[model samples]
Target: MSGEQAGWALELYQRSVLKQQKFAGIQSLLGDTAGKRCLDIGADNGVVSLLLRRGGGDWSSADLAPEAVASIRSLVGGRVERIDGGPTPFADREFDLVVVVDFLEHIPDDRGFAAELGRILKPGGRLIVNVPREPRWSLVWPLRHAIGLTDQWHGHLRPGYREDSLAALLKPWFEVTAARTYCKTFSELLDTALNFGYVIKKRGQGEGGSTAKGTVVTQADWQKGGAGAMKALYPAMRAWTALDGLLPFFKGYRLIVQATRGSD
Candidate 1:
């Protein structure tokens, strides 16, 4: 990843409500990680790595950028490696669980990466992946661009995914066990508006807007007198989250899948 792309990713991991939701989904899927050998691919700020470690798992992290690797090291003392868009350095069948959150959409050769993921997992090992759902709101891109909220600079190569499409992509090496979508219409819209407002406020204050490397902003950042816009929007976001629970049919902005490596 380029420096700008790395910065954008760090900013998302630091401040994006979407990232927090994704993390929640991952934790829900990853119950009782104790003693599991877990690998977190594309670990932006090592939040997942930290979580896995805290669960008593042996956790390792990998990112395509050295800067991101350094940031992960700072956040969690662990085995962190730099990977290109090719095979990773890990030995075959090295891990019991692997995570690829918000990562597949960014790869150009996703098939090759999937095969590599298969090669590194123990028999019947689990793979949990999270990606944006298809039919992404194209209408919001121009506005996001104008406000610097778009991730175009962060190497998002594809638009998003459909359940069938993503399943097909991973079918050759894995079996889909569970799948779910998140960020329903109301919550997604509110989250986007909150992010846009925060960016605008930061720009107005001459703040760079992009998060600095190694600085992982948490909920405390907003609650403890961080960004006023985010603080103001937090309550509404909570309400939207509650409403989303009541309406399950609405198409969400992201897809989460849990699969098992084919024993073949």
Candidate 2:
């Protein structure tokens, strides 16, 4: 494929991925309980805040960074809260529902974090989670230089997990309610691409990998070869894309798990 085609393919893939990854099944499971307090970890740009508010869930947002808290507050006016220090900062049983989306892989000891999530959820409260699949698949870092996202993968300590593995972690605290694999696809020039998917897992782990943190990367001080580099990457990109189809036997794109807090 030509560089221009490769660029277009990548763009198409991104749109497909975003659509799959951002579903609000969490709100549905929360049902009419949305007006209760919600806690969304890794609230990033606070997009989920809007989702919760729209869903009729009154919730506060939490992030690991004060700067992020400030930015979110500026954007939404006192809706976001800053949690200073370490994993799992909230008091016990403080929330009705927690949502953690695509944020678990960054922490090394994910099980410990899940345990903490369980501690903070009220009895029968729900936790919604989505993370990378077991096979650890990702598009070729994608124009890293153009986007200035050097070391983008560093944030993921073990970004991939299987359904059974995830189940084992949460079984102690939550009962499995619903579980499934979900992906969204987009077609471009007769080729269909998947952007990202959720291994939809839920429970009262109160959104363990659910919160947000603050970090930044400045533009790289050097110019990327742009179209030239893409030209060179084409051969590898094609091979990688081809391999993605064949590797399902070993691991999938992600694992989805859903569980609810066990009645104590």
Best model number under lDDT: 1
Off by over 4 Å in 1: 1-20, 136-151, 197-232
Candidate 1 lDDT by residue in tens digits, 31-50: 77788898897766665565
TM-score for all models, in order of appearance: 0.78, 0.59
Q: What's the true lDDT of residue 61 in model 1? A: 88
What is each predicted model's overall lDDT from 0 to 1?
A: 0.71, 0.50
Query: Candidate 2 on 107-222: residue-level lDDT in tens?
Result: 65677778777888888888877666553443433432133332242245564566777777776887767665533111110111111101011123232222234131101100
Error of 2 at 143 (Å): 12
**lDDT of the structure predicted as candidate 2:** 0.50
Worst 10 residues of 1 by lDDT: 211-220
